[model samples]
Target: MARPEPEGRVRRFSTAERMVHRATGYLMLLCLASAACLYFGPLAQLVGRRHLMVTVHEWSGISLPLPSLLGLFSPAFRADLRRLNRFAVYDRQWLRAVRRRRKSPEARPAGKFNAGQKLYAGWIAGAVLVMMFTGLLMWFMGLLPFISRTSAIFVHDVLAWATTFVVLGHMRKALEDPEARLGMRTGYVNRSWAQRYHSRWLREEHVGDLSERRTVE
Candidate 1:
């Protein structure tokens, strides 16, 4: 028996979660901007200071995982990570509905993290690790004689472009859902929005509430 949500609002993300997301997003933006300046001749000349841009790009990429790694210390973030990692029966249904281009929210009802979001998170996590590995290889080419510098650079470049497009798509989708975006930005979502799109999560929250109350009693 959870208490009623106040002002039709319910907690969506913890402060730790929001902080990690913002830090990671800022670092990713920095990495991408610097990468563009390093890779594009026109932009490189426009920005000048090739040496400085290279240093920025390399360090930003290297630091990309720090926020997430630190966030793991927070129980709330770790719980969300578990949610993002696992897919349920509803996730499969959601995917099928998506493939059929179902436009209604009911057709794509999800828990805390949807099927598409889970996939994106998984893909981006893998991409970050791969990018970091290739970046290090490129940065210390002489030290890593086993790995080819040219190959590392090529893979890193292609992945950077792919990641950029995927991030753009993610942002576009976020923009379309103002309430969802607000949840990430402020850590609270309208209760009705959660009921409509994340009914399963709402139910789970209630169950946890009941369990906590029972233990206290």
Candidate 2:
């Protein structure tokens, strides 16, 4: 028998969170695109057009971190982040199930953000910090006389490569998970999706209220 479509509920991402998230995404994309062209394309000359691309890249990188910081202030995002950061005993089992492609139809469930999402969030945060430090050093090489300019360039390049790889991985994971994308898009998910991927959060947020109209699903 075909399974019925899971009923949708409300209570998803807030306007502020969504706006900040979208802004960050755009700025990150701008930074990456400009940097890539400057580093690996014939458009490198365009990078030197009044140092346009470099300036854009630097400013975008600087701006990208702000949205995430602002997101922390949102109660919804804060609550979600807390749930995501919680390290449950069953997370290991989830990892194993993921690897083996053997997650049972019935199993102990997860919260708003899974362990993988938490790890990704942590990694992106670290990457941004590292990139900012290295980028600043590159921009102001003479300010840090203790470190040679050549060494600063090397470190910046290395971190840039690392960030690129990590961001690509993040994009791949997002593409692979439709519900994950949908949650970001409409700011809600079907009850079944919430139950499967974020059961703990659903229970906490929507206790005694399963009707879709009662909450944002």
True-vs-predicted CA distance for residue 201, candidate 2, Å: 2.1
Candidate 1 Cα misplacement greater than 4 A, ranges: 1-5
Across residues 74-174, which tens digit of lDDT does each residue of candidate 1 receive?
A: 99999999999898998999999999999687899799998999999998899999999999998776877878999998998899999999999999999
Q: Which ten residues in a row have the lowest lDDT in candidate 1?
A: 1-10
Candidate 1: residue 47 lDDT (0-100): 95
- What TM-score should be assigned to candidate 1? 0.95
Candidate 1 clashing pairs?
none
Q: Which of the numbered candidates is closest to the native, going by highest TM-score?
A: 1
**Considering summed lDDT, which 10 consecutive residues are worst modelled in model 2?**
1-10
> In candidate 2, which residue ranges exceed 4 Å CA deviation?
1-7, 45-50, 103-108, 208-217
Q: Give the TM-score of candidate 2.
A: 0.81
Query: Judged by lDDT against the true structure, how good is candidate 1?
Result: 0.91
